[model samples]
Target chain A: MGLNIKPLADRVLVEPAAAETTTASGIIIPDTAKEKPQKGTVVAIGTGKKDEPLTVQVGDTVLYGKYSGSELKLEGNDYLIMRESDILAII
Target chain B: MGLNIKPLADRVLVEPAAAETTTASGIIIPDTAKEKPQKGTVVAIGTGKKDEPLTVQVGDTVLYGKYSGSELKLEGNDYLIMRESDILAII
Candidate 1:
């Protein structure tokens, strides 16, 4: 389902992918894994705020999870819409 | 212990607080806890970038973990010094 969301300048909408369950070698990782993978796809991007120009565009894959951000749901999909500053890197 | 780190514009130096280990009632949480807490304190702040002026300063507590940021270690302590863009909120 499509979402009608117009993020403010420099904000972005991201759809987080489900975390990996098993290792590449078919090793079943126990729940005690310390490193949690952070990955997601870009769904929508803001027009780039006046202060910080937008470095990333819509459809770009990104990675982040450093601070507090607002989480939202559109249709039946989950998404995170936050300021561009909240995004750490474009993968 | 102290660190000599001069964060660039809008970047911040945060000291992550240890995660909670039990519930309020002292209920020990198993390693399979789904909800991981994100919290930290601001030890240093950048001068704020050209686009977005620095909104935070040294000693201002902040929360972040959204994207990729540079990780650094000074002396014997570990720290993550990243752009202000990665910071999510000022707690």
Candidate 2:
């Protein structure tokens, strides 16, 4: 069994591997692309924290980096996004 | 003038571009390395937020991904890491 963690604090619940494989310009990305985008879906989100309170919520589709958040497997599915700090942008 | 932001919440202050260029084997890293490591120093830290309290402080060395964290240029030198979530591991 994997972690059934409810991310604490400003952490977010994201289903990793949700990003589009192609660029916005409709260019099918090749494996050699220098900058790769990560795709994920927001499953759950933590309550707002200190000054920089939480802005996004569950079900929001987001994009992150390949090496951003710690890896986790839940119910046989891979997911991540425990902290809001790791998020580069909301999009 | 650039942003001298005091990161709010669980965000940590990290001096980007601080990771070692070589691996544990001391092999010189080639540019073609798939998992490229980004190096930086922790310059400042933010107060902890929510349940996941802040675990790091200023001046601590850290390592992150090249595509992680928002980019910033302070005083003619490039720097980043406004959020602790972006940090992959504390080295």
Candidate 3:
């Protein structure tokens, strides 16, 4: 769980939950029909901006908007870089 | 500026900056060429979450991403409802 890239200013780096590969009845899900994951584990955090410290922390599981955050690949791992407010709920 | 719609959890209501109607040389811009405005004034804000309180307040001039927030028409005026974190900076 280490990366050279670090988020800055209220941004967060999240490791998205794995997309569903199979359905409840064991039907294989196709890539085209798969939806972007909405949940993830916080891997890294930015220094909350001046006068606005973020409430989320490393290792916190969070829910985010379907289109929230920019996608990035760091060290062969996919990550989402989004503002702290993009997070919907802490689960 | 009042609206009946209230944003939920960490959301904020924004009144977008006026689109450019004329260029420096006084050319009339057409509606199709208008890009979504990136700056706005906060009209309303949510109470934030249990532990995470929002830093942006009503009347705060703020910057946001091009596609951030959902557009809504209230009382014949347009507004955007976005999570507080969508705000990039307060001016």
Candidate 4:
């Protein structure tokens, strides 16, 4: 990846997983039933605020709320920037 | 307030304002259109995380996301418990 933007203040940049087009049973899912992927790979992390340290690291898979984060496009790729607290768990 | 619960680690207890039932021009808003109140008064605060201190104090008015925090009822009054970071601003 050639992206060069850095997150600030406990924020993280994530590359969302590709939306699932098929169910586990091999059934094709309609676009209208496709939910936004809630899992993503951490691409960049902030240095964290004073007295706080970030727990997630680059390349770590994380889970977050469907509506969390602000969306931006970089290098023709979509990414989300959100506070660390918005992340629900590290997977 | 006779509530005795103490929030743990950066969490705060807030007393939400009553939902607005009327518009500024005295027009009545339907229940379906009554958005959850995002403003509230701080009733109790936690000691904050290690090396971080709570910025809002008791009696302070605060703003938060519409869907932030967990809801609970105590003493027949509704309250919200959320992390200090969930608070968007102190008013």
Candidate 5:
């Protein structure tokens, strides 16, 4: 958790929720049809802009646009760099 | 514009900025290589969640993720339905 990634200026580092591989009816989801999870846990946060103080916290789970944020790697772990506004709801 | 569409629950309707058809040097850019504009004017907004009253108002020019919102055609004009958080900065 001590990776060097530090979100800056309304950006956030999110650990995306695990993708679902099976449906409620137990039908396995095909790899090509699987979509990236829209939910994630905030691992790091930025100070935010002067006028807009960020509302999301480091431990909060959030919902976001399905394809929002840029993907990157830090310390061998995958993460997404998202603008604070990309997060839809705090869960 | 009196479009019949109304955004619901933290969603905002945005009219994207005009795409740059040419670069600074005036090199004509072709349609095939164009990218969607990241800035837009907020035409409409949702009521927002109980705790998160919306901040951006109609006519506010805002920045958002390039692919963050869903596109829909309303009244012969194109608009994107975006979650409030998908907006990054008010310009």
Candidate 6:
């Protein structure tokens, strides 16, 4: 699964994980209780700022701010576009 | 007035403008109606990232996001510290 759109200027393209429907303890979570997933997989990354190269690579699973990134749909697939700084950590 | 602290790594120290008390039309705005000011004067700036030098300078008046910067008080004066990228424009 590859995207044709490329992120620019330290920005990245990410595919968000599906919302969790069940907790680790096996408790089912209702639709209304589902929060926006903060985890995603990097699909693409920018060339970075002049001297700061990106630490994340394509295929890296990362955590980001809940409100970070702009949502967009390409070919019916949802993705987020945000600066690398918006990513909190790689997992 | 000068502060002892220096902002680091693209961060900038700012003294925010006072909230609006009156509109341009002479209507007085109540405290409860006052919004956070988005304009401020730069007090100090970081050395910037390895290759991206900051565009703002000390004493420059800048416009930033209302929610941008962290609030702090030093020597009985309130200030905000944020990344230079948080600033939207120079005014």
Give the per-residue lDDT of model 6 (tens digit) for A1-91: 5455445557787888777766454434344554533878898887676778999999998878777765544456566677899998887
Quote the positional error of residue A57 for candidate 3 in Å. Answer: 21
Worst 10 residues of 3 chain A by lDDT: A22-31
Q: What lDDT score is found at residue A45 in candidate 1?
A: 80
TM-score of every prediction relative to native: 0.44, 0.42, 0.45, 0.45, 0.46, 0.44
Stretches off by above 4 angstroms in model 2 are A1-91, B1-4, B18-33
- Model 4 TM-score, all chains together: 0.45
Off by over 4 Å in 6: A1-91, B21-37
lDDT of 1 by residue, B37-86 (tens): 34566777655667577876767766565333444333444456566767
lDDT score, residue A1, model 6? 54
Question: Measured against the native two-chain assembly using Cα atoms, what DockQ does each of the candidate structures obtain, in the order listed?
Answer: 0.04, 0.04, 0.02, 0.02, 0.03, 0.02
lDDT for A70 in candidate 2 is 68
Better of 1 and 2 by TM-score: 1
- Per-model lDDT: 0.59, 0.58, 0.71, 0.72, 0.70, 0.71
Instruction: Please state the error at residue B58 of candidate 3 in Å.
Output: 0.3
lDDT of 3 by residue, A1-91 (tens): 4554346568887888777676454434344654533778898887787789899999998878777776544455566778898998887
Residue-wise lDDT of candidate 3 within B9-90, one digit each (tens)? 8999999877755433232223333232256789989998787778888987765666899999888889999987676555
- 1 or 3, which is superior by TM-score? 3
Question: What does the lDDT come to for candidate 4?
Answer: 0.72
lDDT of 2 by residue, B1-91 (tens): 2234345455554555534567564534358758755666776565666577776667676666666654433344445545677776666
Clash counts for all predictions = 15, 13, 0, 0, 1, 0
Q: What's the residue-level lDDT of A85 in candidate 6? A: 91
Better of 3 and 6 by TM-score: 3
Best by TM-score: 5
lDDT of 5 by residue, A24-62 (tens): 323222333323226678999999888766778888866
